[model samples]
Target: MQGFQQSVDIQSLISPLDWVVFAFTIALTAASVLYGNSLKKKTTNEKDNFLDLLLMGRKLTLPLFVSTLVATWYGGIFGVTEIAFNNGIYNFITQGAFWYVAYLIFAFFIIHKIKSYQAVTLPDLIGKMFGPNSAKLSALFNLFNVLPIAYTISLGLFLQTLFGGELLFNMSIGLIFVVLYSMWGGLRSVVFSDIIQFFVMCLGVFLVFSTSISTFGGLDFLKANLPTTHFEPLGGHGLATTLVWGLIALSTLVDPNFYQRCFAAESEKTAKKGIIISTGIWFLFDICTTFGAMYARAVLPEAESSTAYLTYAVQLLPDGLRGLFLAGILATILSTLDSYLFLAGTTITFDLLPIKWREKVSIHHLGVLSTAFISLILAYHFDGNIKLVWKTLGSYSAACLLLPVLFGYLFPGKISDKQFLFSSILGIVFTTYWRNAPLPGFYAQIDELYAGIVATSMGLIICRTLANFRSN
Candidate 1:
């Protein structure tokens, strides 16, 4: 009787119009990928086809660049809302603002250098500057870096919330669509789908924001309902916690999705301008989501905290708009899911395996399958806590690889090969130890992120100082 009652409630939340919009959004995404594939010419050269498939033939304009980049960057949409619902506007300040600074840094300093390299992958560029061994090592960590599970879990939870089902049942079905679109068109397909997704996402969020403000009162209502810490920039968290988030933001410098888009841009100027423009759009979207989540909490305080945004959205929005909003959530996840799956494949075929770029085409497809399986396993492992799923993966990558990748680009040969190797290895080792089994004392107080940063930095300093002394 209880189970039947739950199903009845779920059915009430979605109407016939909502189903039409949801199905249409998905069908349109599939059509877009098929349309992209049809653009390939019979006589296209292998070299040209390779470039076309992976990097969109290095011809992304400013608008395409902005849409794909922004859409892909925020895959953990439900997670963002979860934070906002619980913590208030601080979600925007930490998750959105910290990342904005990192994006600007990448734009001003890194994008030009990356585009100038003409490298297909971050490991390829690292191999050129550091060494093949360094590239291979970075690839191992990059595999951990781009796991698609966080977004997969987000998609799964969204489905389970909207339709009501076991978590794994929804996730398994979600993975099929993700792998299908990703495998069909590669990056071109991903970008094309992103163009559709970007608009849907923006429209859905805006409708909810507008409706919420109109129906539920505005800032005054939020101010009265939310706790003071909700508006606090730091959210009562200390410097250490905030700084850890900043460090995670710094991981953007090493993010392959950013590298792929920058590499795909028609020119350095386009990449630069695109990132700047995208940042503004992200800021606006952040306002909508952050406020929307706050409204959800205010209106539905007793709702399941994980699905608060969707719950309030459905309750507040009209029939068609409810479906559109859910589609936006799926769009947000699918865009990132496909990008990460592809990049993870690149790590396997292009980075880990020593095959010529032109000859290793099939390997990429195989790698995609491998990534999907691994991501599914990880999704199950971390499904218990959605927030920790992303944090754990982000911490591991940021702690171990962020510094070496940054120095490789910025400082180049200033750090010797031996130093670079030790730094990266020690960073991984210290991070694992800090996370799992640090000595109980002052050491226990140090987070894995800080420990990894200190260990890696020490390796570089020691090597450089010894070299200087010996030269003198």
Candidate 2:
């Protein structure tokens, strides 16, 4: 099938009033970053400075944790909307419901344990529990996972849709902007910016959603116009595709953004409570976005799949409101971009680097710059296939790292260094191989997550069994 092409009237999408609102939103976001930097306290030692810069001095409260977590976690606004446009309520089940379950699971069973460790980065936790080798290997995977490539693509798409330009130019400018603010104050900047973005995003979506529903009725309208399959929970993709979404959701267990917030929280209780609260906010936000998507599909059935949400909102909302909605979409993307850029930098400057070197010098800004450039390249190469980019990366990370990381935390000493290392490497190999070249015939139906997870689990089991047998 041909990729979706933009057919919406770009000239009429925004008014001068909307431009002011959109510009104000951008200004507010940048101002918040500068303000965050000013809030940075003087630190006597390098360790204190590093922590203060990267983790907000490990003093995140419930509000800050929840806002930043919610803002950073949902960067794929267009992708989410695309699913909703295509599958209707199925978007709710796959993108919203399954993830809520994961969030709840993480909050209740895992948040306390994560916070108790007080580790700054996931690789640090991995190193402490496993070994240096395991830490470095995992850091490699984590860094690749946290790269802002997909979000950069989102920003590029946003800019292209709004300003009408070459993808490369929009992506470069967007990457530069994201890198500048991210490098300015690190995670402090990210969280502070997220605070403003969270509200803007909420307002933007709320306005568009309210307008859409007011213009077109509600569930009754959807049911009358949409196919019966649209009302189906699975959204007509069948069970296998839905299961893949669940596997993708499993990445939350090892998501660096989640762990970073957990480490940054003031107490274990804050982390748990913040996560629980964020899940609720996510649910509300999903309602707004999914509702908007259905309206978009109903109103403009032939519009570009990637830009349908924004195009429909722009078509329906007034000039200023259209601008605000665009701002919200931009904020959603920037929030995620800044967070991932910072985390990717930390992986380079803090996680992968030797402790002695990292303690003495901070190259986090360099790391941020580097990540933005690399992301720009990936975003360019994977310009049209943003969903594919997310799936490939998400599936690989979840399949390869999820079990080893989770087992490392839950079972602790039960998993040996050798077993963890073997399993993790095998998992990566299996995932990469499966993604690139699957087994022939009947085995081809099984995807990367299943193949990688099963291969890694079986390897770990066999190794442990052999070790036990030898000892006995």
Candidate 3:
């Protein structure tokens, strides 16, 4: 119970009305996820067991699956964090849309190839092409990337700031809201919540933002307040740097979430449609959130963290509106947490744990325990994780995935076991080290992308070449 009293600084100015809005949103999200689950159960005779819990009974519908997949990447902080630091206009480029565009490119070719293999997870596909050794190693790298997860700290900071020490009840409940919902409902719960959340966040964020901009001397006020250079190309970087910025942005495509969505979908058509549509919606959502950060920059003081949109919301919004805004934030956080717990649990169960456990142990118990355990460990280890957990997710993700999925598609039989192993290793090494080139520009990202792309490409080419030579 004492651990329930964990104190972290949050910047909220929320009141009683805010609590009502949040409660309503949670109830609504819960209902939606359960409804979706019920439909799936009715269609299939699959009893609700751990395997079903682990994989949503493999009956995930098109709409809910798409919403859940999109929410996996469109985190509350992901939308709101960069707005202030980059001055809104500059950060417009770093978005989930580009990620979707990346998906669009892959959907026509790569996804079908991956699906053809009937691989349960990405590693399963790799093992078929490369070897068991590579799959095992790939899992290790994935664990490295996925482990030390964040959103806990970001959420913690926001929730603490939102309540601002007013009510003992609010802080405790808000802090555990993500951990609780995620643990209780698993992936099914997370997706349902996300459908409600994404829309609410869109509405609440737009209102808080548009209202704040109107209040604080309008558009002219922002222009006058922000540094003139804020509008400059690259913010502070130079010409070659901006070009590099454009290309490096392309690297967002080669992420784990990219292929994971394909696997998560009910069918290939739904998978393709959901991702493309989500891209557009995500773009609109990002714009509103970034504008809020820009408005905050014009009016609010510098806080302990740059990623403090919730902080601005608490201190800025009217009491009634603040409730709506906080509720939106909770919706986003819950969707993200529940989805992550499900993913994490699967990484262990489907991805790591013994398949034979079904013969000996209860799969339901295993699914629940593993999900809760990983969620708790990751929650506590939130502090020790590598760079912004998102970036770490991106980093660990980019290397392991980029090569195999693409090769598995275009040059299917060409990829050799040796090539897949070495290329992925190189990709990981380059991503981990090249991140700190000290240029304070896109060059750093460019270098990392080059490292991943070149390594992956070379591996594929070399493998195919060798295979051909041997045949000749």
What's the TM-score of every candidate structure?
A: 0.95, 0.95, 0.80
Global fold similarity of model 3 (TM-score): 0.80
What would the per-residue lDDT of candidate 3 be over residues 198-287, giving only the tens digit for each residue? 777777778877777666767687788777655654556555434433443444444444555566567777776776676777777777
Query: Model 2 segments beyond 4 Å from truth?
Result: 1-6, 360-362
Candidate ranking (TM-score, best to worst):
2, 1, 3
What's the C-alpha lDDT at position 1 in model 2?
9
Backbone clash pairs in model 3 (N, Cα, C under 3 Å; residues 3+ apart or in different chains), count: 8
Alpha-carbon local distance difference test for all models: 0.83, 0.83, 0.58
**Backbone clashes in each candidate structure, one number apiece?**
0, 0, 8
RMSD of 3: 6.0
| Candidate 1 residue spans exceeding 4 A from truth | 1-8, 356-358, 438-442
Q: List the residue pairs that clash in candidate 1.
A: none
List all candidate RMSDs to the true structure: 2.9, 2.7, 6.0
